[model samples]
Target: MPRTAATPEQRAHIREQIRRAAVEVYDEKGMEGTSARAIAVKAGVSVGTLYSYYANLPELMRSLWAEPVAEEMVRLRATVEATPDPLRALRALLEGYANFAFDNPDILRGALLFVGRVQDTALAPAPAAVEFDQMLRDAILAGQKTGQIKPGPAAQIAHQLWAGVHGALALPINIESLDFGSPKQIVAEMIVTLMASVKA
Candidate 1:
């Protein structure tokens, strides 16, 4: 039988336990291979208990996946917001992006695979994708307005930059040879090249 939602403290305990067990299973078997029954057993709960909290496997996986990305996004947004200089802000954003991917390589790979599979199937953007694209657009506009970047359509520039970064990151995961350099080194070079295109 499923465990019912409990008091706040009980809820916290259950959620934390589930998260740890989920990560372990995911790490060992990858997201697709990790099953609710296995996760429940690891968490000392019934599969029904897992369903009580999460509607399905994808829902649970999405929640788990969002945690790290959401945290990184918050940190990146705060860093960008706090920086007064446009060029420095862009650099910080790129640095944060690279660090997030490098530090959480497994999660990053899972997310990329999931995103690639689901992206065009829906017309509406996923929450993370929308927020990420918006952040890039905002940064580009800010740079242009501050005269740190040359005048151009902000949307066009944002798309170009996003495409460049996505392709760079994706290649490393897809092709072994391309994974040779540290992501930081590659991102730094990409940032420099991107910035040069926009310099006033």
Candidate 2:
């Protein structure tokens, strides 16, 4: 007899289970400690079945790590476009990003840890990473044209601002022992500082 076809919902369910399982394992036992077999067991699927969904561990990690950020990036792009005011648009965009990072602290931590030591081969350019930077660069350029921001290289300024966000968010997530303010507060303050510093 031919195998019964799996419905789209069933496939989605299984994929979600696998992703959640990976997250749990990665959380409990850092990325290095977790394996595909562990994730399969946690997901209640055979190793073969897990492989059917993801070719390997990195593929699964990539999906779990990058998918949400990509979605956020799309939303941010739309939100910024909707508001023609560059200052308000940029504020909203940065705030949205900080909220995302704050909400998904564990995932952000995992991503930072995983990327730091690993070679470039481990990560593809995140769509959000590229798109967010581009949007930021454009915002800076706009501000410059309006004489609201200093005239300089938009790319470099964008990089500095982006780095400030990532660096501030990363410390709280990575070093659990270190005392720090909430991620939201840090990000908000960082956003203000960065914008103020760039003002003409």
Candidate 3:
């Protein structure tokens, strides 16, 4: 039976505890092997309790991983927002992107895998993706208006830049022996190349 909580504070605490336990289990078991019963035992709750908070295993995992991804996205958006200059803003964005992936490789990998699998089937996007798209689009449009970026459709330029940045980061991370000097260095170079491509 699920533990009954008398207060909102207690319920919130139990929910956090369950989430923490789920993250630990995910670390060991990966998503496929992790189960609600397993998470319940680790969390000291009933499987039904887990279900009460999260409708299903996928939803739970989504919430679990979304925390880190959302955090990184916030940092990325803030970094971009802090610098009004187009070029400097782009550099800061690139660095934040590289740093997050480097610092949280496990979370990054899990997110990438989950996103790849469910992206086609899932109609609703996690909030981070939406924020990222908006920010990047705005940035590109701003750059074009400032004459820092070459004349092109802001939408196409934003899409290309976004894809390029991820490809630049994703490549060396996936291939250990690919031998980029460092993730930051490669990302910096990639940013330069991308900036040049877009520069007026």
Candidate 4:
């Protein structure tokens, strides 16, 4: 069971198991309440074995959040790339962004733990976050090129799209009582209204 000799698939599977355990423990017990021992027991591995896979709990936490986000980024990119229609791709990207949150609530919540605890990387860009940002920019660029999008700075439009969907996500969390309708529906209309302003 030499770690160095483990196949990529083997390593990925083990890492996934560790991450799932960490996520469950983290959700039930706040980050401070979670420990290497708890994660190890939950994962059915020895504490020493867990450390062999991850240097510490914090590292595991980062991986738990980062890995899923990266995977979702791949999904989002594929979904966008598959659609040739610019407007359709834009819609796909927006829904994909919201779906990222919906699909991985635990990992996202676990990541919030690092906000203040690890200042350097906490606020820093995760690779998946970066990729998602790129997809938004790419989608905007594609729309602009096809004349489906209004003429405006691609980056600005991308940022606006990002912020708008992000707001959609936040409203549901912060004000659960208010019926926002479906996030996608609200965002789809936002997309149309925004695109109208920028259309050539």
Q: Ten-residue segment with the worst summed lDDT in candidate 4?
A: 112-121
Q: Write the per-residue lDDT of candidate 3 for residues 57-116, one digit (tens) a residue.
A: 666777877878888887887788789997778667656766777787776666654432
38, model 2: CA deviation in Å? Answer: 5.3
TM-scores of the models, in the order given: 0.67, 0.73, 0.71, 0.63
User: In what order do the candidates fall by TM-score, top score first?
Assistant: 2, 3, 1, 4
Greater lDDT among 3 and 4 belongs to: 3
**Can you tell me which runs of candidate 3 are displaced by over 4 Å?**
1-14, 31-41, 44-52, 55-58, 65-75, 112-123, 175-181
Model 2 agreement with the true structure over 10-69: per-residue lDDT tens digits: 999999999999989988988667888899999999989998887667767778878677
Model 4 pairs in collision: 150-198, 150-199, 151-198
Kindly give the number of clashing pairs for every candidate.
Answer: 0, 0, 0, 3
Better of 1 and 3 by TM-score: 3
Instruction: Note the Cα lDDT for every prediction shown.
Output: 0.73, 0.79, 0.76, 0.72
Candidate maximizing lDDT: 2
Q: What is the lDDT of residue 59 in candidate 2?
A: 68
Model 2 residue 12 CA deviation in Å: 11
Candidate with the larger TM-score of 3 and 4: 3
- lDDT, residue 128, model 2: 61
